[model samples]
Target: MESQKGKWWKKAVVYQVYPASFKDSNGDGTGDIPGITSKLDYLHSLGIDVLWICPMYESPQIDLGYDISNFEDIHRPYGTLQDMQDLIDGCHERSMRIIIDLVINHTSELHQWFQESKASKDNDKRDWYIWRQAKYDDQGIRKPPNNWRSIFGGSAWTWDEATEEYYLHLFTPKQPDLNWENEAARRAIYASSMEFWLKRGVDGFRIDAVNMYSKPPSHPDAPITNPSMEFQWAETLYCNGPRMHEFLSEMNEVMSSYGEIMTVGELPHTPDRSEVLSYVSAAKKQMNMVFQFDVVCIGYGKDPKFDVVPHDWRLSELKKAVENTQGLIMGTDAWTTSFLENHDQGRSISRFASDKPENRVQAGKMLALMNATLSGTLFVYQGQEIGMVNMPQSWGIEEYKDIESKNFYEEVVKTSKGDSKALEKAKRGLQYLARDHARVPMCWDSSPQGGFSTSTDTWMRVHDLYDQINVADQEKDQSSVLSFWKTALKLRKEWASLLIYGDFELFDLEDEHCFVYAKRSDCNVALVVLNFTKKERDWKAPKEFNGKSFTLLTSTYSGDGKPGELRPYEGRLYVQV
Candidate 1:
């Protein structure tokens, strides 16, 4: 493992905030930077080391803030550049680092660079983006240059009448992919975007869809994976492509210029273990860590995430994913990121465990223990600490605001052709997999609109159970989910040696509904035992662990250091005494 002598990030807890849903200080029914600044105390109280704000750049709102129109400016609705500076200063004053999303994989079609590239055949920025001539079919009809499919749905190629060319867009048409092959484009992004933020005192960046930056040189048509598919496969061609490491290394040179900064890339496809290690290896000096999708893909059905599907996961699947990831980087200089949910995925309590009223707290604590204690940088998304559940199933298709979710719903309904079961499946998929499930406003209190905003017309509807799950209720109770998170974070920082730099091993992989693991460092050992189910299960201390005297570090139950039968959904941490 990389030396943990001065790397604060090795033991840091990062809190991810979807700026649009965090808070709104102006009562404009939309969250803003000032609103986030106002909540600094609340965040610091939770003992987080860094705050990871989602994209706030200028955009057309096609994919929330993911589609950047202006790299250096802030989105109008999010507030002015001054507001961002204030937010940064506020965080620094509180000794909390702030990292914003760096979404350079693609830019909105409305972006000036893209507009100029599509304006004419020989514009100055013509090569800035990937554009190609359309091929004519036997019937004299125009077809895309290649058979690449968009991640959102349909063809990845979009035709431009003015230029008589098809531009590449791996996501929605508005998000046209950038050509990283152009050295000028890469340098321009570094000068105009990344350096601008680093100069503003922002600690680091969470690169969005980082693996899609490089595309193949040949630009050949993707192979047909399924005979009856509407579009061909493209992820294999573009993701982790030939020149990805080269581009990242060039970018890393700039990051290294800064004294102390963190960078974590969000890699979509499951990359080979050695390939992943190269990205974050201390010798490579590329990225500090990466967020791979293997663990999160357990609940994804037979297909990719764009296909609407309900939760279909086994506890063993999660264990395998976690184990494989841990095994790859156990004694290596490379590092990994651990997170159960993000802006693209649903809540963990709802997706991984039973979120009924009686089991919410226990389930939330159990999931927290599972991720927070592992050897990685832990990321806690907004509302995750408070045990938030998925949105009500009564929400209809119209209630959904996410473009990807809505597009999936239309695709399923159209293909189903009035099949009742397919329609029901789509509804369940939305409930379990929709990005909107994590986009709901953070419930700060039981006030109108859950204290997210004074306006009743918030951007997204507040969770219906806000009254019982709000921060106000949790703050008063010592056994609340929020309290457990605070305690967990406190213990993690206090025992950094055992949790951060220790050796990891699964305690009992054979346990049906319980996940047990141990962290050993030198002569000290820390055991983490968790029950993923709602019903109480009999668990005996393993033979090797039974002989040693132990001290309880933390638990979901109300007991002290006493060892006995674990309750339902209980999680206990024990340290050798």
Candidate 2:
């Protein structure tokens, strides 16, 4: 039995706002912190229980907001610290909790700590970041400490002339990895980065790349997997280091010091189920829940994170991923995040189901039902509620502003030596699974700018289909995707005892076209069936559920619901009668 823990977050659904793309308050074209405040009523109507704003901290915006220059200060374009406070207060006024993004795994190279660390060999903060001396070959050629490729591509180390040593950067050279091994440095980071907001009335945090905190002490070269390239990918080489749990536990203790708090750690290249459970287990108190990547990563190829090559995903693969997660804490003291889209992933409608004009609405609602009925906290990305799809293929690579996608594209081009076939395949793969899909500007109206900004220029391009998919149009249609999402969320809350805390059991585990599951509580059993493809699928209750008749609670398709048949991309939630 999944523990019936009564945390407010467990009964809540989160709305993630990528501030720069959500909505623009001023005419500056870039979405600001105040922009988020201006739309509180809209979000409140969607029945979202929590608001999770991505990083908008003081930064140069190199990797958007992931590279923070100042932990506590707000970015100039984003707005003043007062704007953040207003957003926080606005959420509370509307009976919703707000959480800000926390990017502690790394910081901008221009950060004061990094500046000082590179100033001199004797600088007090020299050890605050991971730095290694150059290794000289027989011919006196300098080389990086290891052959570990940067997550985005190339060597992970960047040479620093001032320090005469190479600094480790898992991502872009500008974002240096913080050395968590420095106990004093870790304590100082916790106090400066998190305490400032917790002091103000901010509810909690959505920790970015939380699992990448620890680094291997030895920094050895990984086995060469990509022979075509000089460097290789080694996520196993860096994740879950010797001191990861200790660091998280200490961070958890500090979060607890503040009143009630919710923290979610993102494990990009997650380890095994038990390792993931250890991070969120109630006994450890590391986090409220963790976001697992398996469900989103089924199509990921050999070199998981860096490789965008797509694979044909089957219904069984989806079932396995969902069951693996549901089984992780079935009778234990752990919880996991339930979501289908986020800033780092593409839209769900484009991935799991057809995004064609004719089927988009049904596909969107079907995905929403899957997200809401899952046995953990629900997290709905900004445009996900309205069924936003991927960017058009007509858009060139230059239009993709996501650093990871652009980097991967460029790397493939260089590695494949500009082979036409390889480039075509790479582009197709990226179009299907790039991060930019989730970061695109929100579609709010039929206006040319999608009502996101007053200016013609946006930091990221707005979706072209905004004319037909904007919230302004959807809000008025009773059968729109937005309306269905509202109903789904409301029902999730109304059936919390069965949907949130209930035990999950997979039905017809080998089904190829549909996803079926049962959520059972002491007094109720709710069945959720989702058709993942365009063809209709049929399902019948197994022996255990034979005596029970199910009544349609809600459905993605309109009209009377049939007990055993599911239309193309149809979804129906039923309660045992």
| Candidate 2 residue-wise lDDT, 138-239, digit = tens | 999999999989888789999998779999999899999999999888988998889988998888999888888888888989898878777888788787
Clashing pairs in 1: none
Q: lDDT: which candidate is best?
A: 2
Q: Rate the local accuracy (lDDT) of all candidates.
A: 0.85, 0.87
- Listed in order, each prediction's TM-score against the native is 0.97, 0.97
For model 1, the stretches where C-alpha displacement exceeds 4 angstroms are: 304-311, 560-564
